[model samples]
Structures are given as structure tokens and as C-alpha cells.
Target: MKIRLWLIMAIMLAAIVLAATGCGATTGPSTIVTSQQNTGVWVSGQGKVTAVPDVAILTLGVQVQESSVAQAQSEAAAAMNAVTKALGDKGVAGKDIQTQRFTIYPIMRWDESKLQEVLVGYRVENSITAKIRKVDDTGSVIDAVVTAGGNFTVINGLSFTIDDPTDLLGQARELAMKDARNKASQLASEGGVKLGAPLYINESGGFIPIIQVPIARPGIGTPPS
Candidate 1:
């Protein structure tokens, strides 16, 4: 009887250990499942609008060299003033003329023999951007400035663009939205699903075409020392 009792106690202890450890449980090692619910389809669309530019932008300037910084700056200022008067003569409004850049720096020549840089003279550059409403007058305005500013005149670059781009941007936005709607509808048809109303909308950007003007280097005689 004592042997039988010991055997029963051993069986009971094994049952208690299995219950504590959950050995017979079917639940796998605490598995976690993640799922992304499909909400809607995403589509991207683009639109472009182009038109001939009505305004011309020119970067005109005068650069002068002198032995002293004050002298160079004075000469540059005089030349730039003359250029501004020339623009005014061509009917460019005061609001349309803006000083773009003005700089004064010492001219340094690299001396290869001495392995150093030698100061030659002070160079002053004064520049302004003029928006010409009359695109056809671009050449005449440039010529007039050159004549007025004389030997220090410099024509940096020219570009053509529309004065106002609001209308163009609006048209492009409408077209882009239409394109997106059409694409979404097509996708919904192919996938055998109903397209829901747009819950969100975003505009990437509008395209503006730039008309590159040929670089024209104006001839300016050497500055008087």
C-alpha cells in the first residue's frame, strides 16, 4: 500500500508541474499578427501650360577699375546712374528697375615667379535688373544703356517670362486634378472596386516654361585710367 501511495503522489506531482508550465497548451509562442487595411488608391498627375513671354528681364551693369577703392566706386556709381537714366528714357518705370548686385573687390594677379598674388587695382561692379514691358524694345534699351554708360558697361544676361503667372498656374492645377480623377476612375474600374470621394488632395507644383535668350556681349571700350 505504501508503494502504491508513492506512485499516486508521483503522478499528481507530474500533473501539477505540467499545469504550472502550461505544457499542453495549444497557443503558439505568443504570436502577433499585423495587417494594413487597404483604404484607397493613390495616383499622381501632371499638367503643363505654355505661352509666349510678354516681358523681358535684363541684367545690366557697369564695372570700373581704379587705383583706389573710392575712385573705382565713384566711377562705377556714375556709370550706373547714366545707365538708369537711359532705362528711364526707354520708358522703363522706376518700379521696374532694381539694383541687383554691387560689389567692390581688389583685383589680384597671381605671380607665378614669386608664388604670391599681387594687387593690381580695385574693381567696382554695379548691376541692375530692368523689366521691359515692351519686349521689342529690349535691343534698343540695351544699346541705349551701352551708349550712355560708355566704357564700363556690361550686359550679363537676358531672360523672357510672363509678368503674371496666376492664370497659368490656375489652369495647370485644374488640368492636374482632372487628370488625377480620370486615372483614379480607370484604376477603380480595372480593380472591380468603387472609387470613393476624394478624402484628400494635394498639388505638387505648376510648370513654367523658360525662354532662354541668347547671350549678347555688348562692346564697351577700355576704361580710362
Candidate 2:
């Protein structure tokens, strides 16, 4: 009877030890699964597409100098009026004409004889931006401004851009996605693991307008940023 009781106790202790060992084995696999779920590959890609621009934006202005502020302002207004009329005559819409800046400031010059700075004159500047729909007529519009404002007229900047870039953007996005997938695949292969399905995707870039303005002449203007 005592032998039987001892055998039963030994069996129960072995079963308890086996249960503890089994629990520890299960925990290791659970930790590994949690780590895998929290980790993933990250990468970025870039794409570019070139297409002919269909629109032009022009920044032109009038600057006048005079002995008094009132005189300078008057001269600037007259020049700007003529410039607007010229633009209207060339088919530019009123809504397309935007006033970018208008200012009147005094100019100072160093009087070497007096050894001090002195007020010389006042200067007035008025800047206007015009969006030209007919790209081919850009040269003629520039000529019109020059004829109206003469030496006071300054072409500050010009830029060309694609009015509708939907197709180009789609193509660029596809290329970027492919680039990312390729990089991820290469990394997975080198690491001796099969690439899993992508758990997340994000777009990092969008269309950037072209700024190169094909000027008909050297004095047209520089491109804006």
C-alpha cells in the first residue's frame, strides 16, 4: 500500500513539472510573434516626368523716380494704367491682371561734400502679375508692356507650367511604388526571408511645376522660384 502511494505522488510531481515546462515553451513563441507583428520594412522612392508646358505667368512692373513723393506716385500710376490698357488690347482678361505690389519710398544718397546722407528723391514702384493663357502670344504681350511703359517698365520674372498634370502625377506615383517594392524585395532576399505583403503605403511627393520660361529674347526676365 505504501509503495502504491509513493508511485502516485511521483507521477503527480512529474506532471506538474511538465506543465511548467510547457508554459515556458509557449511564452517564447508568443514573444516571437509579437516582435514580428511590430516590425516591418521601410523605404522611399522618387519619380519624375517631363512634359511641355501649356501656360505662362508673367511678373512685370513700373518704377518711377521723381523729386517728390506725389510726383513719383503720379508717374507710376500713369505708367501702370498704360501697361494695363496694353494688356487688355492684347486679349488679357481683367481678372488675370493682379497687383503684386505698390510702394513709394524716399531715396537717400551720400553727400560727400556735406559728409552726411541726404534725401535725394522719392521712388514709386508698382508691380503686376499677368497669367497668359495663349502661350504663343507671350512675346507679343511682353512687347506691349515695353511699348507702353518704356524704360520705366521692368519684367521681373516669368514661369511656364503644365496646367493639368493629372496623367503625369499618376505615372510618377506608379514609378515610385515600383521603386519601393523593388528595394523591399532586394532587402528581403538578402536577409534570407520572403517578402511579406505590404501592411502600409504612403505617398510622399506630388507634382512640381516646371519653371523654365522659353524667352523669345534675352531681356524678357529671369524665372521665379
Candidate 3:
């Protein structure tokens, strides 16, 4: 009788242990499954917009070649000085006129017969960058530079820019966000999914300078409208 009682106790203990083990396993797996089901899907979208430039910058220079370095440099300097003076006379501030490039290089004459090189003359170049706050005066400034002994070959043309791009960039970002949301909504509708609040938002776009045709002039003329 005692043996049978001990055997019954052992069976009950085994049953209890098995039940506890099954409960622990089920609880952990259920928690993990719930977490996975609650996870959301990620979607992405992009957009772009055009903005008109508000400022114009022009680069102008004078290049002169002469028999000697001194002569070439002197001529280039005089021409550049005349150009700057003309700009100042036309209400360009001293701060706005900046010297961008000044170079003096030897003009090499290659001799094929002797396999030698000779310095025939020297070439001097001086370039100045002018930030014209008034876009209307860009053409006029070029004309003025030409009239002020700025020879034809050295006049590099104008480049357009935005003086303050901060406001425009902000507007662009807002537009981009709107575009992304619209795209997401359309996609969700097509896929038969409810559009949820954005789990993540990533915005990326930049302003690029639009280039205009460079005007070439043998001599100065009326500003382009």
C-alpha cells in the first residue's frame, strides 16, 4: 500500500512540473508574437521645386601680353585699376570689388629643329569678381568695364545667384514634405492599407544654380533685358 501511495505522489509531481513548463514557454512566445505584430512598416517619398535666383555676380578681368614681364604686369594693373575706378564711380563699394586672380606667365616659343624652348614674351592677367547687388546693373557694369580700358578678351561673363537662400530653402522643404505625404497617402489607398502617422521622415534636396548663356562682346553694348 505504501509503495502504491509513493508511486501516485511521483506521478502528480511530474504532472505539475510539466504544466508549469508549458505555461512558461507559452507566455514568452505570446509576448514575442504580440511585439512583432505591433511593429509598423516604413515608407519613403521625395520631391523637388524651382526657385528664381535673387542676386547676380559677375567676374571680369583684364589680360595683357608684352615683351617683358614688368610691362605686361604694368599694363594689366593699369587696366584693372581703370576697371575698378569705373566700378567705384558707378556706385560699387570698395568692399564689393575683390581681386580674384593675378597671374604672370612666360610665353614659350617651342623650337622643333633644336628641340629647345625660348621665352618670347610674357603674359599678365588680372581678374576681379564683383558682387552686384542690383541685378539690373550686371550688364551695365560689364559695359562700364569695357569703356574703362578693360580689353575684350578678358571679360568673363556673368553668373546668377540667390543673395539669401535661407527663406527659399525653407519653403522648398515644406513643399517636399507635403509632396511626400500626398504620395504616401496615394500609395496606401492603392494598396488597401490605412495610412498611419509617419513613423519616420527624411528630407533631402538642394538648390542648384541655373546657368544662362554667356554674352560675348567685341565691345560694350546695351544691357540685355
Candidate 4:
């Protein structure tokens, strides 16, 4: 009877140990309780605007070729000097007129049939780049250069630019932000979610050039209105 009692006590102790160990084991992941918080929507947007150009840039040059390098260089220099004087006479500041390129290169000729190479006369080119703050005078300036012995053949077309781009870029950024907000709101409404504040914002600079339009005047009938 005593042995039987001892066995029974041992069995009870083992059962208690198993129960304790089972309770100490790790539990499963806790449940994530979601409330009435709305889901966020993402969006991207772009904006563009046009503004008139306030400045003009002109590139003018003279090219001369002669049998001797010195002669070629002298002719190019003389033409460029005349161009500079013309610009000065027109009230263009010395700071605005800048020499952009001055080069002297040997002309080359090759005969494909005979496989012969020949060195022709040297060609010298001198160019100047000028920025004019007054856009209205751009055409007149080109005319002056041509009349002042500057080879009009070397005159490239004019390019237009804006004097200040900061204000324009700021306007573009504001428009971009507004567009982004509208897009986000629209997406949220369609997806049955809520729109939140922007997580990020980015912007880029913008500029548009003015293009000249050519018009021909024939016998006018109602001016083609």
C-alpha cells in the first residue's frame, strides 16, 4: 500500500511539470487590430506654362581663306574689328560682346582615284557671341552687322531667352503641387480610401523660347482674317 501511494504521487508531479512547460511555450503572433483609420493614396503630376522671352542671343563670325596663314588671319581680324565697332556704335555695352571662337585651320584636299593628299590654303574664323537685353532690336542689330562689312553668310539665326526664370519656376512648382493634390484626392475617392498629406515633393526648372513667325503679303483680300 505504501509503494502504491508513492507511485501515485510521482505520477501527479510529472503531470504538473508537463502542464507548466506547456504554459511557458511561446504564443502565436498577436492580432493586428485596425480602427477607422483611412488608407493613403499616392500620385504624380506635371505642369507647364508659357512666357514671353525678354532677351536675345546672336552669334556672328567672319571666315577668310588665303594662301598664307598671316594673310588669312589679317583679313579675319579686320572683319571682326569692324563688327565690334558696329556693335559699339549701336550702344551695345563692351561686356555684352564676347569672342566665342578664334581658330585657324589648314584646308585639306584628297584625291580618291590617285590616293594623293594635298594641303590647301589656311582658313581663319573669328566669332563673337552677344547677349542683347532688348529683344526688339535683334533684327536691327543683324542688319547693322551685315552693312558693316560683316559677312552675313556667317551670321547664325538668333536664339531667344528669358532674363529671369526664378518667378516662372516658382509658378510651375505651385501648379505641380496643386495638380498632385487633386490627383491624390481623385484616386482616394475612387478606391474608397482617404487622401493624406504629401509624403514628398519635387520640382524642376522651366523655360520657353519665343519663335518668330514669317508672313507674306500678297494682294490682300480681307487680310485673310
Candidate 5:
């Protein structure tokens, strides 16, 4: 799927300096310096890049409930092991499979006769975050994991993103600079001034991932491990 890389930069403006000997006024931030003495108009600009996602991230796990903690843990462990193996068989590297959570908690039920809650059994959950570098194989990988985990499979969520955003960020930054300069030029022209050079530029940027949320997310009362 298509993903976006958005970038914005702050091109601060300062007062223009008067030229000597009938020379032109100094340029600032690739546009004519604002001569408004702290009353200059503030311009905002953004540069965006659209690209295909190179990676797929999956949050998946296995959960089991049994009358005893050991039984729950054993079943959950076997299912999770199979899930990890399935990920590997689907070309996911070992380094990409990371255990995110493992919890065992009492499954409680209300005892109407005693007017108190009693532990009927225990629930064990084991989850992992796996990264699939081959984005095209995401669907097959998910299928394999689900099949391996069987009835206890829990697909928390999935997301698509760039593995390394350094290059994309650099490209976006260049575009943002160009966009800012263009806007600055427009402002200068409207204010009846010639375009000059840039004076101050401060760049800030962030990345947003494209996520495919599940229709239902499991409640998170499981104890952390």
C-alpha cells in the first residue's frame, strides 16, 4: 500500500538590512527579508512523499485458559512456539521476531452463594511483535501464523511502514525547503519586494505509520512479564 512521508520546516524571518551605495536590500531565507519590523506575515509549508511500504509489522499471540497455571502456560507456550516457527518458515528473520508480552493471570467468576469472586482457572497469554521485511509476503505470513497458532490465535494488529526512513526523510526535507522558498517568494512579491536569500531556517519533522486496526482488540488486564 502507499505510505506518506510528510515534512514541515520553520523558515524564520528577520528585519532586512539596508544596502550601501544604492545597492539592493539583503536577501533572507531565499526571499526578500521581511521589512515589517516584527510584524511580518508567518508562512507555513509542507513537503510530502508517497511511497510503497517496505515492511509489515504484526502483533500476534496465543492465549489459553486451563484449570491450572501450568496447563495454561504449557498450551500457550506450545502455540507461541509454533507461531514463531511459522514466521520463520515465511521468511521472517529470527532477529525480527521479538517477544512483546507474556502473562498469566487468574480467570475469576462470581460466586453468587458466597457473594465473592472465585478463581475458576488461569489464563496465559504470550505475544510477540514480528517484522516482515518482504512486504509482499505479509498476507501469506499472517495466514501461516494464524494456522500455526490454531484456535488460540490472537491477531492484535498489523501495520505497514518503511524499514529505514532516513532516505525518505531527507527527500522530504529538500522538498519542504523548496516549498517554503516558493511561499516566501510569493509573500515577498505580494508585499511589493524583490526575492532575496534566506536568513534563518530551523527544520522539524516526524513520521506516521499506516496501520490496519482489528475490529476487536482484546482487553489488557493480563499481568505484565
Candidate 6:
């Protein structure tokens, strides 16, 4: 069986009621209510829906250290090149693989005799983020990169998400609207006032839900998730 992540979401909804005592007026998120309306009712509703994740994003990189910056960078470059090749061979499209970070810095060590920090070596770090459309192949894709990079491979992060949430969002939106209207109807019944159509709809936008699987950096050659 393959690993799967659940995407949970909430949609925002508001129902506006026009008061009969007030003259016709218009404001944000509410339609114009005329003097015939007796009361303004504002209510919020939420909708929750679950979706199965179909996409995986992996953040991995190569880190190497040597006596000089050139040596360190050369080795890192070679390793990164091999890693990218492996990714391509594993069906990852070239466009989906992107470099996220590339850094070169000096390594330091404490020296008692010098009474200061001594320059030990230089390190090169090259990281990339890969978007895997096939969720089931994520583990295999990671394995390929690790094998290609050898000991310099480091896994920074991994997460799962939905590719297209339009359908799910539509479902949530319907549920939310229904919830809002129901609440408004109940309020009107209690207040003994006529219920009116929604004057305003507020949309707060949406975000992709993520499931992060924590994994430690075990270096290349070690098994990856």
C-alpha cells in the first residue's frame, strides 16, 4: 500500500439580513436592504471537506566539504549533476526540479593554541526542490537521487498536497453557503422578522493542506522515504 495524506479545508460564509426600519442602503458583503426590512442578521458558517493528496514535494541537497572552496564546490557540482540526472531518469520532468539553495561557506574549528577560531575547510551546499506528480513513486524517486549523490546527499524536507483543489473547493463552498442560510433562517424565525436573500458574500481565499513526514538526514547511500 502507498502512503496517502488527507486534505482538510474550511470555507467562509456570511448571511446578511436587512432591517425593515432602515432606508435602502448598501455596504460591504451585504446587498441593499430597504426600509421594509425589519432587522439585519449577520451570521458566519464553516464547511469542512477531506481530499486525498496526489502530489509530493521533496527538498533534498548535496553538502560537501574540502580544504578549499574550489574543491568543495567541484565535488558538490558533480554530485548535484548526477542527482539531477537520476531524477530525470526516474520520470521527474526537468521543469519540476528547481534549485532552492546554493551556498558556499568556510568551516571553523576551535584552536586552543591560537586562542581563536581556526579556518578548517570550506563547505558547499546545493539543494533542490522536486515536485513529484505520482505520489506512489516518491520513495523510489528519493532513492534514485540518494544513489546518484552518494554520501553528500541530504534530505531537508518532504510534504504532500493536492494538485487541483477546484472540485473540492466547490463542494466546500456549497456546504458553507447552506450552513450560512440555515443559521440565518433560524435567527429570523426567532426574531419574528422576514428573511432576505444574501446581500454580501465574503471569500477569504484558500490554502493547500500539507502533511509533513519528518525524516532525518542520513547521507547518501542510506535508505530514504
Best by TM-score: 6
lDDT of 6 by residue, 1-225 (tens): 287678787677654353322323443344444642334677777777888888899999999888788888888999999999999998999999999999998888878999999887888899999999889999898889888898999989999988788888888888887887788778767877665456656765465578898877855432111
Candidate 3 accuracy as lDDT: 0.58
Error of 6 at 221 (Å): 12
Clashing pairs in 4: none
Clashes (candidate 5) = 10
lDDT of 5 by residue, 1-225 (tens): 333432222232223221221123453334434463243434545667656677888998988888888888888888888999999998999999998999988888888999999888898889899998887777788889888888788888987777777776776767776777677667766776655444445565455556564524433324323
Cα distance off (Å), candidate 3, residue 9: 84
- List clashing residue pairs in candidate 2: none
Cα displacement (angstroms), candidate 1, residue 193, comes to: 2.3
Best-to-worst ranking by lDDT: 6, 5, 1, 2, 3, 4
TM-score for each model: 0.75, 0.70, 0.70, 0.68, 0.77, 0.86
Candidate number achieving the greatest lDDT relative to the actual structure? 6
Q: For residues 30-138, what per-residue lDDT tens digits would candidate 4 score against the true structure? A: 3212331122334565556566666677777777777778987777777778877887787678999988888988877785777997666788877788777777776
lDDT of 5 at 48: 70
User: Model 6: runs farther than 4 Å from truth?
Assistant: 14-38, 220-225
Residue-by-residue lDDT tens digits, candidate 3, 1-225 = 011100000000010001112122322232223343333333444334454555567777887777788877777778778888888887788888888888888877777887999767877778888877666676677678788964523567666766666665666666656655666556556655555444334444466554453767554211111
Candidate 5, after superposition: displacement of residue 95 in Å? 0.8
lDDT of each: 0.68, 0.66, 0.58, 0.57, 0.69, 0.78
lDDT tens digits by residue: candidate 2, 172-216: 766766676777667656655555455445565566674754443
Judge candidate 5 against the unseen true structure and give its global Cα lDDT, from 0 to 1.
Answer: 0.69
